[model samples]
Target: MTGLLIGAIIISFSSVMVRLANVPPDVAGFYRLFVGGLGMGLFLWRMGKLKHFTLHIWAWALLSALFFVGDFFYWHRAIGLVGPGMATMLANFQVIVLAVVSVLILRERPTAAFMLAIPMALAGLYLMVGVSWADFTPDYRVGVVYGLLTALFYALYLLSLKFSLSKAGADPLAMACAVALLTGVLLGGLSLGQGESFAIPDVRSLLALATLALICHAVGWFLITRSVQMVRTSLVGLILLLQPTLSFVWDILFFDKPVNGLEIAGVILALVGIYLGSLKGKRGK
Candidate 1:
């Protein structure tokens, strides 16, 4: 529980940091993942655990990396368009997307609680974008679409991670390193192709990027990876609710983001929706 809380808190700053880095979204993802992969590599080397992975594990981890990179790419774009707070919440709609996909592909049944949660979550998502539907301009609409794509890609990452972890018996750190390395290389190429600079803009931006790489990507996710093994998957899902919740708070506090009552209500509603949706797995257990 402590690990999850701390991890969520650390990662809640990810969007804010990316926005502050003042780089193109893809460049931000590249630097963050590349640095993180290096850090993990160093750690594993020190522990004498750094070694080649089996081809089967490498295959799954590489596939997962594509989805992971996609999530970062779309999420950063969403943050630029919709603002960090809304984008974070919107990206987190992965819970719902994952649930629906599970029902379709994995033949999982939706419980009554999950069915009840769907409308509430959707309505909350509506209220979250803006108080009135009119507030969603054509540009912001694009952001919303990006946000949904972020969720979809993240869902794919999660599912693929599950397969790699379970079927391949992949070591978590090995998988993380692989994903980070692969994603970094892929995004770095994308950034270069788009004329994004590899140079850090300034000291503060470098610090922000370093914080993202070491703290959020390495330490935060390491804790989450460890805790997930120690805790129930359903409970982990519930605890991860902190990421978006605290992200909203960070926006208001650090960025001085304005909000209306409807937005507050939407946050509450979404929280409730996520909790209800997550309950399905818990009850099944």
Candidate 2:
């Protein structure tokens, strides 16, 4: 619960960081991976377990990094295509993707309440976007596709990262450091291939992006790692349900965005859906 709460708070700052960042989305993605990796390095140095992590762990970390870094790139691009509110929610639709994956991989089914509320949540989200779409240009559909893909990849990232973290054992500091290095290397290569500029960010964007790397990415990843250690993956999904909610609230508070009647309905519906999903875990606990 502590870890989940921390993750929620960390993620709450993410879009605000992106909104304030004037850098290209691809460049921002690069910094997130690399700079976040730097934070992990600092953690490992302080803990003195740096040498225990191996190349094999790095392989998994790099794989996880690729999925996430790729998601960030597309997700940020999606924000440009669509508005931040819907894009953030849509991209976080990863939790639903995780549910589908669990059905296939873990042989689990959602409870009745969850099933009943999912479509409502989705419908509320769709209604939110449909209104946005109605007002926005038609070309923005490209972002919707990107957002969908980000969710898929993020779900897989959640699964794989946890598996690797478990395999790496309780040395989260070590795991974080190794993965950060691996992730940074991958994102660096990606930035190079994309021909993104190496131009230093202005003071405002740089400060914001650095804070994002520390709080939103580094601290957020650390907290989520702790959550994976403490809870079952099933409830991990439920805990992650906080992210979109946080994202929505952050947009309203910091971005000076207003939610419409239906958008509020969507929020209520999603909360109900998440509540239903959480009931199974609560009963077990």
Task: Give the top-scoring candidate (lDDT).
Answer: 1
In model 1, the clashing pairs are: none
lDDT of each: 0.83, 0.70
Candidate 1's error at 187, in angstroms? 0.6
TM-score of each: 0.93, 0.84
* The best candidate in terms of TM-score: 1
lDDT of 1 at 279: 61
Worst 10 residues of 2 by lDDT: 276-285
What's model 1's lDDT at 71? 96
TM-score of 1: 0.93
Q: Write the per-residue lDDT of candidate 1 for residues 38-75, one digit (tens) a residue.
A: 87777777777666556776787788888898999999
- Show where candidate 2 strays beyond 4 Å: 1-3, 166-173, 231-240, 274-285
- Residue 252 error, candidate 1, Å: 1.2
Number of backbone-clashing residue pairs for each candidate, in the order shown = 0, 0
Q: How many pairs in model 1 have backbone atoms within 3 A of each other, for residues 3 or more apart or on separate chains, i.e. clashes?
A: 0
